[model samples]
Target: MSAAVHSERPALLVTAADLAPQALALLRDFDVVYAGKSPSDDDIARLCKTHNPEAIIVRYGKIGAQAMDAAPALRVISKHGSGTDTIDKVAAQARHIEVRAAVGANAAAVAEQALALLLACAKSVPHLNTRMHAGHWDKASHKSVELAGRTIGLVGLGAIGQRFARMALAMDMRVLGYDPYARDVPPGIEVVNDLDTVWREADAISLHCPLTEDNRGLINRDTLARCKRGVIVVNTARGGLIDEAALLDAIQSGQVSSAGLDSFADEPMAGGHPFQGHERIVLSPHIGGVTSDAYVKMGVASTENVLAVLRA
Candidate 1:
């Protein structure tokens, strides 16, 4: 007997960089259109129009109303990571498009990255290593700070923030978490709804909150002024959460001792961004959730989310 005739698979647009093969395997029945890494909203709109995809998987960059309008048949939008600010949920919801994120998929990885940055800042890892490589023993000049007795303030107490809090607690540090929307605070973390409390109490501050209009300049000069002198800062959240100019000024003025940054307001941080050549800053190219394991977990979750929506 002749084999059953196969039908053309529905199309899925993916914008992440070098998506995991396993994810594509999970989506074996779908025709995927991969936009290059960091595709603009306009790029998304254009791609959606050209491909006529039923769903879109955003790895990075914003998916706005324009992109949503471009795909008349678009049924769902999925994020590879937990953050949904990059996607215009209101616009998606207005048109009856469901939005899903790979929640908890990259939480551990992102938490680990935040901790790594915190440790690097506390111990002055980058500065020491750079000086050591330059043939300077500089140990006496740059002493490492101990994490055991310090207080860490977390701006968000979601999965990633909670994971990081546990790690910090294991190191004998005190954790203060500020999440206005969280239902319960994790064990060993002191929950504070007031932003001032976290800002005033923490020796080290790490941002894990989503970017929103209200919290965009959460860590500006005025906020930094409230923090302890020489307080270490780490951000694994959206870069726009902190005001760049204010952060730079604070760093220069010694209000902020050091910073560990993974996200930035303008990514691919242009040639003359102020953070460059700063000895006290540890900058990463936005790879907090880009670890190998996280990629697979996020990928699988993203693909499954799309399929769930499309098939439902």
Candidate 2:
């Protein structure tokens, strides 16, 4: 028999940075290799060759074919969040590597943030807070619309989107969903065939789609023009789906009333970004899935996937 088929136990590599205490405890059970904050492809290659990990659990970084080539024995890869755009899934599948992620681990956190943004946009939250803190009582600027009896158009109706739909329904809001692959619409949601109709009809629009070449910058000037005037937008999913330049222009021109963004086109966003001082946009450093519960759930799921592949 060849040496390629002789390895017995599987080693695992974990490239996540600053793991919570509970996550660390669970990950410690495996024969694991670690790396600094953002390990380069070469660094990852070196580590994989040295450890020969059968599984790798990574977060928020690219894992291309080169990285996978470095570990000939790797059988599985686990992502810490729902978004898998960071990893090359096609390459992994070609290598017989099973890729898995915590599908709904951060659904509640994301839904909460979406609601917060919707309410803030409807009621002018940041604006009023600023005035109150500056010792000015201005009720005029605080006049806002209620969330009840409004339509919310959700682009993707996956796990997180379903959760948001339920929440919106509970708040007495009409939910409209547009997902080409969605098999069934929830009890309260109205499923639409095309996206342009949702863009024109919804009072608020929240995106939950993956970032792919087909949908990159889908929300451009033309789409913005189709959206209802003063439509509030929220994005807890990938950043490239919406054209940032078009969005900024809409916000300035009173087309897009407000936006809540958890992810950006470029993460660790550059220092002097235009949206930094904009009160109409609420930004949260890509922390939609950073809660302790999500961390534990992801750690457990990833560890389970690793162990399954190792035993196989």
Q: Report every candidate's CA lDDT.
A: 0.88, 0.81
Name every residue pair that clashes in candidate 1. none
Worst 10 residues of 1 by lDDT: 1-10
TM-score of each predicted structure versus truth:
0.95, 0.92
lDDT of 1: 0.88
- Residue pairs in clash, model 2: none
Clashes of each: 0, 0
Per-residue alpha-carbon lDDT of model 1 for 1-312, expressed as tens digits?
Answer: 111223477778888556788888988887778777767777778888777778988887789899888889899999998999888888998999999999889999999999999999988888888888899997566568898989999998888999999999999999999898886776799998798998898999999889998888889988999999999999999999989899999999999999999999988799978899999899999999989999999999988999999889
Q: Give the TM-score of candidate 1.
A: 0.95
Query: C-alpha displacement of 150 in model 2, angstroms?
Result: 0.9
Q: What is the lDDT of residue 301 in candidate 2?
A: 68
CA lDDT, candidate 2, residue 298: 72
